[model samples]
Target: MVKNSGEGISKSVLYLMSAGAGLVVANNYYNQPLLNLIATDFGVSESAVSNLPLLTQLGYAFGLLFIIPLGDKYPRKKMVMIDFVFIIASLLIMALAPNLLVLIISGFFVGFSCVVPQVFVPMAAQLAKPEKRGRAIGVVMSGLLIGILGSRFISGFIGEYFGWRSMYFIAAGIMLIFWVLLKLKLPELQPDFKGSYKALMQSLWGYFKSEPSVRLAAVRGGLGFAGFSAFWTTLVFLMEDNFNYGSGVAGTFGVLGIGGALAASYVGKLSDKMNKNKLITIATLVMLVAWCVFEFSGHSIIGLVIGVILVDMALQSLHISNQNIIFSKNPDARNRINTIYMVGYFIGGAIGTTTGAYAWQIFHWQGVASLGVFYTILILIFHLVFKKSLA
Candidate 1:
């Protein structure tokens, strides 16, 4: 039987959360492969279309900062269901958008609603038995990882065949189906904090001010991610420009990059068993190598494949590892802590997307690869200074 608050979650509900989180989060990524199509339809330059992803990520950052804390003050199930309503509307707007302005505005809402998956993550944590919490979170994470890895590939093929709008249409339909499923399957969860919105916001700032570890980890992970985001933002453009390949070919790289994402989960486990400083240090050094490969050899497919794997593995390592550090600091404050860290994270993504597009417009692959190396170098500098916390 399905359990209520703090009791064990049913296997079916757990699977639903996993699938729901995956599909919902995938909404954030579907645009990457479709950027080429978006550019073509709008008759805009690569730099212009880049704003779509950039704005979406910025929107996600804003939502993380602002909306996440509400879960602490209110029932989660109702909040998620409400978020889905907005997501559906946004996806529909995107599917039928008449102008770039409309698409960009709606894209932001999509990212904002994309925060729903994050809500599911914490919900899974609360519902599973203490002994099984890790496994539960891992199951959900696996779903998330698969959704991320598969979205590009799925969207690429769909966008190539049925028109880019169809992808959004299909995504909207899936969200609608899940919306109904969740309403039926999910039990209402109680609020963890009884604080007002003002106090919640204040506490987040307090953590940022007081936690040296949060600061270090957020900075290290954010800037490091900016570089990798640049690569992803520019990858489709690269495929089209250099190899005369389409979105489908460009997206297969997502599949190839799965190794890196998997490597991140491994590093997350190691955070408990290994020294944080040593673990991150090695990951940083590995990131440098990935960027160097991109700079020198990214023109070739084999080189591109290798660089993608290495960079993803390295970037995701920083994410999972840094996240572990923050979560360890104060259990009661995890929601707020996650809010601050993710805000910085997605903000970095927005900047990287902008940088990638602008770089591609001018110097092409060399510029993209060079800036990536530069970002990795900056991460290394920051890590050395912040490595104390990792110890």
Candidate 2:
């Protein structure tokens, strides 16, 4: 795990990695803002729209268990390149889907293949010095977070202007360009584990048991992400129903939060210098406050926009801090830890999306805000109970 800071990452290499991560990871989010459009187009119920997030998340969970483990046994750069080709094809399938069932199937492939960034995050960590690993991961992850947020706006705009199908075309094009760039710029990294798939899967439990902090950090991240997603999963509905806004107006909110999402680089640097426990504690506090802001911002678009920025800042900052801590624990095994960590995070996210939608159906925006607040408190309690172990 020895790093070479003196060599430093070149701009071309960094762009190759970031762009690859962005385009690949964007697949996870393209469905977010498009849920309403998809639901209407397919003649499905609003409740059914919830399944897209749930199924996509299940796909991500499946990938962490099945697909991502290959990073430990195969050549990652080639794996990523091959996966991008599949991502492009998958988006085409999603765009051309004839029914809701077809779209759900497309969502699965999108989630499964979008894990290329999971490979890149650890790879970036492996490439940097111990002191700079957090910063490296942050920079790469900022690309990822940006893709998640920006794609919402982009997809919404494309869907609004040209058509929802155009959203997929743009995504495919981005992935195609990313494929060419990565193949040209990214250096090969051989996998550390050369065992059979069964052996690799079995070893996951052993790795989990051996790293307590990684486990705590993973759970903490899972809960945090769940709360973070709960607000967003049902946001478009709230916008349309409560605020009386169109998809385009609602999507513009994504741009408002980009500043917070882009600050991960600074947060990563701070994580490198600050006490990990203190950083996480502060982040949770911010999230708690953000949820309260959201709860009180009911019926006001400007108020909700302000809350989104604060919540985005809190969530992204905590994400950077959590990643900094967990990835710091095991360098060679980062891919496995991330696989474990992100699986938990996305499972929580899946649950959030499902539960958030139901909460909205039952109690509307109040229910959605309540879910965020409830999870935020739950995470705080868990962090407190596990404080000794986490430390």
Task: State the lDDT of candidate 2 residue by residue for 111-165, as single tens digits.
Answer: 8878888888888877777888778888888888787778788877877777777
Which pairs clash in model 2?
Answer: none
For each candidate, what is the lDDT?
0.80, 0.80
RMSD per model, one decimal: 2.6, 1.8
TM-scores for the candidates: 0.92, 0.96
lDDT of 1 by residue, 1-391 (tens): 2223256767887778878878988898899998989989999877788889888888888889888878777888899899999999999999999988899898998998788866776676667765455445555665676677678888888989899999999999999999999899877777767778999888888889998888888788788878977888898988888889998887788888767655543565566567767778888898999888888765699888888888877776676667666766565566677788878878888888888888888899999999988888888898898676546
Model 2 CA lDDT for position 105:
89
Error of 2 at 189 (Å): 1.1
Whole-structure CA lDDT of model 1: 0.80
List the candidate 1 regions with Cα displacement exceeding 4 Å: 1-15, 124-138, 263-265, 389-391
- Candidate 2 is scored at a TM of 0.96
